[model samples]
Target chain A: MVKKFMALLRMKYIEMFAYQWATLAWSTGAMVQPIITMMVWINIYETEMESFILYFSTLILVERLTAAWDVWDLDRDIREGSFSNYILRPIHPIHWAIAENIIYKGLFLVVLVPAWLVSSFFLPSLQLHLNGWEWMLFISALLLGGGIRFMFSYSCGLLGFWINKVTAVYAMFEGISLFFSGRIAPFSLLPPIMQDISLYLPFRYMIGFPIEVITGSVKGADLGYGFLGAFIWVLIFMGILGFLWHAGLKKNQAVGG
Target chain B: MSIVVDHLNKQFKVHVRQAGWLDAFRSIFKREYQIVEAVNNLSFTIQSGEIVGFLGPNGAGKTTAMKMLAGLLHPTSGAITVEGFIPQEQKAEYKKMMSLVMGQKSQLIWDIPPMETFLVNKAIYEIDDNSFNKTLDELVALLELEPLLNKPTRSLSLGQRMKCELAAALLHRPKVLFLDEPTIGLDVDTQEKVRRFIANYNREHKTTILLTSHYMGDVTALCKRVIIINHGKLLYDGDLDVLTEKLTPYKLLEVHLPTLPNQSWETYGEVDSIEEGKVTLRIPRERIREVSARLLQEFPVHDLNIQDPPMEEVITLAFQEKSHG
Candidate 1:
């Protein structure tokens, strides 16, 4: 099993590097979104660079670091039966999907690093309060956040097993996430009750939880509690996904129409 | 050491509907179903290292049976085992020793060269570098894939891509190969070449090859033994020569004489066709020798030949026998 996992990882690495040009294009596209958000916020705040610079830059940082691509790929795979190839491979195909996710994430960090540094320099007052322990906590939260996001989105992809076409459903989910996960605007800027509600929901933990860690709002015991919630949600995602996949497989075998 | 299939059956539940948006909408809430017995009570045993041709017409459960052996589909009520492993168990060891190649379906990465896909499989299979290189080199040479290996799969012609597909599927040197129409849609020369490669590869590696193809040419060329199935039931299973004799009691004889003989040929056998100086006759299998001898003596025979009834006819008869039964 260990050897097979290593092989899966190696295959994913070779695939990522082979398609390096497209990877570059996509990561560039990811960076551009945050950079544009940074510019728009700078114009909006104008003179008040204090909270504006800190919050906006941290938002961009969290977005870039916590990106997940499998949600989109997974939906397409389920639609076209490309997932059949994954199903037939000897090892559990989820490992390959996860390996692909890690590769794309690793590549995106490289793209975001220079942009992060340059953008910070341009915004002179931009201050990301970072110390060793806090930075380590932030990194952990970011990984957990990415994991939670993948699980939720992957479960969304599973909807394809029941529905003939899931594009409209997936699009609606995306639209909800754009607002719900603090992608378009920070949770605090929304109605106060909505922000508090997001804290318990998986969607906020997917995006908002990591950004909160980055901005230093989540500290001490809060960090541990937040992590516990994230892991629990991950477990929930897995449980639901397992039930759905088994049911879908039964349906597939019964008719195979 | 043997593939054992006993009373294996597959029933497909298919949605019944006709075209048009209104029908589609109505059918969504109120759908009808029809049961299709793709394979029923089919039983066969194939020892290791045997190359058997699995012959059937379209929608005749040929692919469904192959899928069962490959562990892709579950049998409805019967048992299928290979070397004591229930195939549907799909043990990793069982999968490691088996390979499936469907000619119409591809496993290669479309945007990249086939060699790249081979490398991916090499990684997935965890083949050591030395073995991977050795096997790849041998397959490339055998399939004559050197020139085609680096060309993107999308760029290669159908035949070229199929050669690559064959090589890719064979990289692990599987012990059992399930080939579904592996030479379908290829030119005659390419088809012949593929058949020769399969024969030579089976000879060298002693791989158990179960091939299903629409082309009778494929079976006539590669398979010495054939298993015939129709409507999910075993129609016949035995040596190809014996099958021809049992299923078709008659043989074809083509006569090319300098001129039409003055004597009536009906006394010799059933006359199939007569054109100009040529006459084709169908005679009972038992009477072949006597009929040929009599024809030579009676007619000024320039050239004469005896042949088995065409495979297409035998299959048609097999289906008729099946449906009637």
Candidate 2:
């Protein structure tokens, strides 16, 4: 399994380079919305400008690190019947998607880490101040966040076996996630009820919880609760993915000859 | 038997919609579905080291059956065991022993060279270095793929890409191969090359191959036996020559004469076509020799040639006979 994953990663890495300009554009393009939101918050809350800058900057980095596009890939592949190629292979198809996720995220890290460091040199608010334990916890939360996001996207993609418009359905879910996952604003700024709701839903664990961990907004028992919530969501999505995969294979028409 | 398909069937629930915009809009609210029986009660067994042509017209369920055999689609009812392994189980051991290639769909990564896909498969199949290198060398030489291997799949011509596809599917040297339209849309020369390669490879490897192709030349050149299907059901399953003889039990006799015969041609045979000095007749198999001899004695025949009916015509007659019956 490890050997297969390594090969898949290498192949994905080469494929990514073939679209290097597109990769660069996508990594940089994702920053626009958060940066624009940061500017608006700065104008609205002049006294708390530094904290808002820190929060949205961390949001951009965490978001990039956790992004998943497998839904689009799966939807297109299932619709075109090219997915039969993977199905016929000896290895499970999910490993290929997982490898692609790892390669793309690794590229994002390579590009974004330097950009964050250079920006921090110019703007002190962009810098992170965390102890060793806190850094470890933050990294754990980030990986968990990435895992939850990947499972979520892949599960949605598996719905393509039943529905023709799965990407459109995923877009609807993504729109809802925008407000609930703290993309537009931090969870602390949301109303009390919305914050409680976010805690129960899986959206917070995907993007918002990781940002909270890095920004020191989640500490003490709250940090434990965040991990607990994220862990539960992971198990839930795993269950959902397992079920979809088993049922979807039978449901798959394998559309094209 | 290398592959056994018993009462195999596949049905699809397809959404039915009319052509106009109003019906399309109405279908969004209240959709209608119709069941399409793509493959119905299809049963055929292929022996080890046999190359059998899966013959069918468009929408005749040939591809559906192939997909089911490859375990890509679940059969509605029936059993298929390849090498004593149930295909729909999709076990890793079963997959490692078989390969499927669809000419209409590509397995190669488009923007990258074909070598990358081969490397990916090598890992997935866990092919050792020595075996991989040996098999790849043979395939490259046979397919003449050394130049095309480095070129991006998108830049390669259709024929070149197809050769690479074949090589990719065969790197692990699968024991059983399922090919659907393996030579579709290629020029005659390229088609002949692919046919010859398949025949030679099968001969050398003793591979069990079940191939489906619209091109009659592919079947005639590579397959001695054929299983014909129509409307998802098996119509005929036997030797190619036997099916041809059964459906079209006559020979095409073309006689070249110095002058045109003034008598009615019906007394001779069924006149297929006639020109100034050349006449073609459809003669029954039993009387071909006697008729040819009599024509030579009566009319100063310059040249005479006798041949069986074309494969396309034979298959057409087969379908017509089955449907009408």
Candidate 3:
């Protein structure tokens, strides 16, 4: 099992390096969103004499670091007939996809760490100082967010079993994530009650919860609740993902074999 | 030491359809199902290292049978064992022992060199570096894949890519090779080259090859025994030469006579066609010597030749007979 894991890691790095230029383009796209957010928030702070602007700019920093990867993998695999090749292999192709996500997430951190440095340097308002308990809560939220995001997107991919054209579904998923994940604006900035409503949905837990903790939007009791909410949603999505996997395999036709 | 498929049966739960939009919508709500008996009560056994050709017309269940043997598709009701192990178990050891290649589908990664695909297969098969290199060197030399190895799969011609595909499938040096129309769509020259490669590979590795091909030459060149099926039923299973003898009992006798014979040609054999003063007759295999002697004495024959009916005729006749019965 260790050999398989190590081999998978090696393969993931090799594949990522081969498509390094594509990765660069992707990271650049991700970077542009945060830069645009920072500019807009800085302008908004020009008028409002409040600390909310500090949390808003910090929102940009957190969103830049935590990016979701699902639509691209699912949409491309559906478009190319290459998915057949994946299904034919003895090993479950999901293992490779998981390894690739791990590699991409690790690589994203490289750009993310430097981006954090630059943001804090230029805009001191983007940095948040927290106690040890706060840090623990924030990391836990992020880990739970990863699980929620992976399982939800995987369940979306299994829609391939029923629909031949799944790009529309993926497009909708991406569009919703961009808004609900707080990439457009901080979850707090949505509407008066929208923040409470967002907490009930998994999308907020996937991206918004972690970002909220990092930007110090969550107070002592709220931070604990956010972590708990993320964990519960992760369980829900995990169940959904497991069900979709078994159902998808049963419905598999093995076309053109 | 042997592979056996006992009472093999396969049924596909095909969705039934009516041709209009309403039916299509109704099918979404309630689907009609039909069971297609792809292979029914089929049984065959093959010993180790014996090359058997599976011959059948389209939809004759050859592929369904091959899929069963490869453990890709489950049998509806049957038992299949290869070397004392059930195939559908699909253990890593069982997968390591066999390889499958389909002519219609390719395993090579397009836009990348074949070597990349080879490396991927190496990783999947868990082939050690030393064994991988040795086996790859042997396949490269045998398949003449050296030139095609580095070129992107999309750039290589069909024949070249097929050679690489074969090599890729065999990189693990599988003991049983399920080659489904491996030489399809190749030029005659390339087909012969691939046929020779399969033959040589089998000889060197002592691999058990169960091959399916539309080209009879592919069957004759590499396999001495054939299992002929028509409409999912085995029509004949034995020596290829014996099938020809049993199905077609007559030889085609073409006589290029010096001049037209005024006498009736019934004494020689059944007259099939007489054109341009050349007479072609079909004579029973047993009467060939005597009939030729009598024909020579009676007619001013310039050239007389006797040939067995083409194997294509025998195969067609086998299917025709099965189709009726």
Candidate 4:
């Protein structure tokens, strides 16, 4: 099984390289949003501009690492009857999606790390000063965030089995997540009510909490809460993912080619 | 028995809507649905190493029945067991033992060479390195895929791609194969090549195969026993020759003469066509011997030949009979 999984991962890695230009284009496009947001906020809060640069730069890297777009591929497969190929196989289809996610993140990070380093030199505020323990916690939080976000997106994608078009629904969720997950701005900079709400919601745990951890903005008891929140949300999303997968398989029309 | 399907039925709940803005809008809130019996109370069984042709016209439930058997679609009701495994359960062991190839649906990675897809299937099926290499080599040799395996799937011709598809499906050496229209659009030569490969593979591997195709050549070449279905119902199930004999009561007789005969040819048989020096007639199967002898004695006949009506004609007649009934 491990051999099979490793093969799948390697195959996906090679496939990604085959479309190197597209991967580069997507990575470049992803950086645009965070860079633009950083520029806008740097002008707004002159004194805290350094912190803004650090937060958004980390956000850019984290977003690329945690991103999961299997939903689009799933939607197309369902519509085109390509999903039946996976169904006929002994293997569960999600492994292919997981392999793709890991490959994309691995390749994207290679590009992102260098980009981050170069930008840090140009933008002095983007540098990070973190202790070893903080680095450990940050890495853990980053992985948890990626897991939560991936499951969340995948669960939403499973809606395609029930509905004809899931894009509108996904877009709605993404619209809300942008504000709540700190894609637009850090949770602390938001209104007090939104910040309080983000604390309980899963969105912040997916993106913002990890950034906060790595930036050393979250600490002490608050750091404990962040970890707890991430854990609970991951469990909730994973549970939802399990339910959705079962329900989706049952509902699979297995539309003809 | 390698396969058993008892009272297998599949019904699809299809939404009904008329062509109008109001009806389309109304359907969103209170849509009406009608149950379509795609496969109705179908039942058949095949022994190990037997190749059965699933004969049907468009919308005749052949593909649906095959899909259910392959575990791609759930049957509405009834039981199906292939190799003691209920297909609907889709257990790993069952899936590992069976493979389905739809000619219209490709499993290949279009952007890459077919070898990549084969490797992916190798992992997906979890075949050991030794077995995988051996099976792939055998398949490649059998399908004549040595030259095609390295070429990108998009660049390969349709016939070449289908060969690769077959190779991909068979890499695991599935015990039972469901082939749905495996030669649908190939040229005559390619079709013959595919048929020969399928026959040779079945003989060598003793793979239980259930094939569905509109082309009678495929059925005639590969299947001794055929199950005919029309309108989601079984019309006949027996030896292919027996079905043909039962459905068709007549044979075609063509007579070539040195000169045109003025006498009416109806006395000989039902004249299908009469040309300058040749006359074609549909004669009863029982009278074929008698009719040919009489025609030879009566006409200035240069030559005469008797042939069974085409299989396509027999199948069409069978379907027609069902519709009339």
Structural similarity to truth (TM-score) of each candidate: 0.90, 0.98, 0.82, 0.96
Give per-residue CA lDDT, model 2, range B1-325, as digits (tens). 9999999989999999999999999998999999999999999999999999998889999999999999989999999999999888889999999999999999999999999999999999999999999999999999999999888899999999999999999999999999999898888888999999999999999999999998999999999999999999999999999998888889999999888877788887899999999899999999998998898888888999998888999989988888898
lDDT of 1: 0.78
Best by TM-score: 2
Model 3 residue runs over 4 Å out of place are A1-25, A30-84, A106-144, A159-163, A166-179, A190-201, A219-221, A228-250, B16-33, B253-281, B292-308
lDDT of 3 by residue, B161-243 (tens): 88998998898888888998999889999999999999998899899999999998898899899998866678888999898
> Where does model 1 sit among the CAPRI classes?
acceptable
Clashes of each: 2, 0, 0, 0
Compose the digit string of candidate 3's lDDT tens values, residues A44-155.
7665423544554445444444455664565556444345446545666667667767787788778766776776777666466888977887778777877777777767
Candidate 1 docking DockQ: 0.35
Indicate the residue-level lDDT of A206 in model 3: 79
Q: Runs in model 4 with CA error above 4 Å?
A: B298-303
The fnat scores of all predictions, in order, read 0.18, 0.85, 0.12, 0.58
Quote model 4's TM-score.
Answer: 0.96
**In candidate 4 chain B, what residue range of length 10 has the lowest lDDT sum?**
B260-269
User: How do the residues A1-257 of candidate 2 rate in per-residue lDDT, one tens digit apiece?
Assistant: 89999999999999999997899997899999999998998898999998998899899889999999999999999999999999999998999999988898888899889988999998899888789999999999999999999999999999999998799999998998998999999987889999989999888999999999988988899999999999999999999999999899999888887
- Model 2, clash count? 0
Write the residue-wise lDDT of candidate 4 on A216-237 in tens digits: 8888999999999999999998
lDDT at residue B27 of model 4 (Cα atoms): 89
Candidate 3 falls in which docking quality class?
Answer: acceptable
